[model samples]
Target: MKLQQLSLFLENRPGRLGAPLEAIAAEGINILTLSLADTAQFGILRLIVREWDKAKQVLEDAGWVVNLTEVVAVDLLDRPGGLAEALKILEAANLNIEYMYAFSLRRGDKAILIFRFEDPDRAIQVLLDNGLHVVDGDELMSFVP
Candidate 1:
């Protein structure tokens, strides 16, 4: 299971983040989740939205460069050592994690985590083989609670 994420490069300055967000908001696109990481010069804004294509168009039309990247959404127990167990499995499979972010919604003691792996296909297979649940895009976006 995989999801498409929109990434935008933003300059490290005040109000730079508001422009693209306002544009997306103007189009009535709701962001499911987002992660913002910054360095000295620039920041990378990663967003997961139900209307990804529309959101990308809105940003691009606003004179911003948008990149689409594939990431995996995983269903993990909201308990101690939950993440560690997953990491251990991945480590055993020799998979590399590029980055990760989490959605705040807790669905019945389950937490959804977004992971960027070097090889997503293999990682998904490995996780499934270990009896882990990998969430599909539709399932992730359709979660009510």
Candidate 2:
């Protein structure tokens, strides 16, 4: 399964990040997980939210350049080495994970990892073939606050 992720540019300065976040919040969208990587001039914000289109609309309307992409959400045990185990499976399948971030529901002993792969659909197929539980957008929104 795959979920849509939103990526946008944020100037590397205080308060630049707050504008987009505030836009999403004003629309009542919940950010499930996010990762920010910065360079000298700007930063890239990768976010998975409860509602993708609405979130993107808000950011773009507010003058932020927003892009929508596909990402895989894999289910993993919430324990030591759990991630390593999942990586091992992808490794054996010759899948490369470009990047990943994680989040957990309020009451589950499980972690949900959002992955960016060279081939998103293929990665999901490989994870499924290897007995890994690949989660979908609706499933992820199940625990939204």
Winning candidate number (TM-score) = 1
Report the C-alpha lDDT of model 2 over 1-145, residue by residue, as the tens digit.
6899999998899888888888999998878788897899999999888778989888888898999889998888889998999999899889988888875453377787889999998888888888889888787777667
Query: The CA-based lDDT of model 2 is what?
Result: 0.85
Give the residue spans of candidate 1 off by over 4 A: none
TM values, all candidates? 0.97, 0.92
lDDT of 1 by residue, 61-83 (tens): 88999999999989899899999
- Give Cα-based local distance difference scores for all models: 0.92, 0.85
Q: What is the lDDT of candidate 1?
A: 0.92
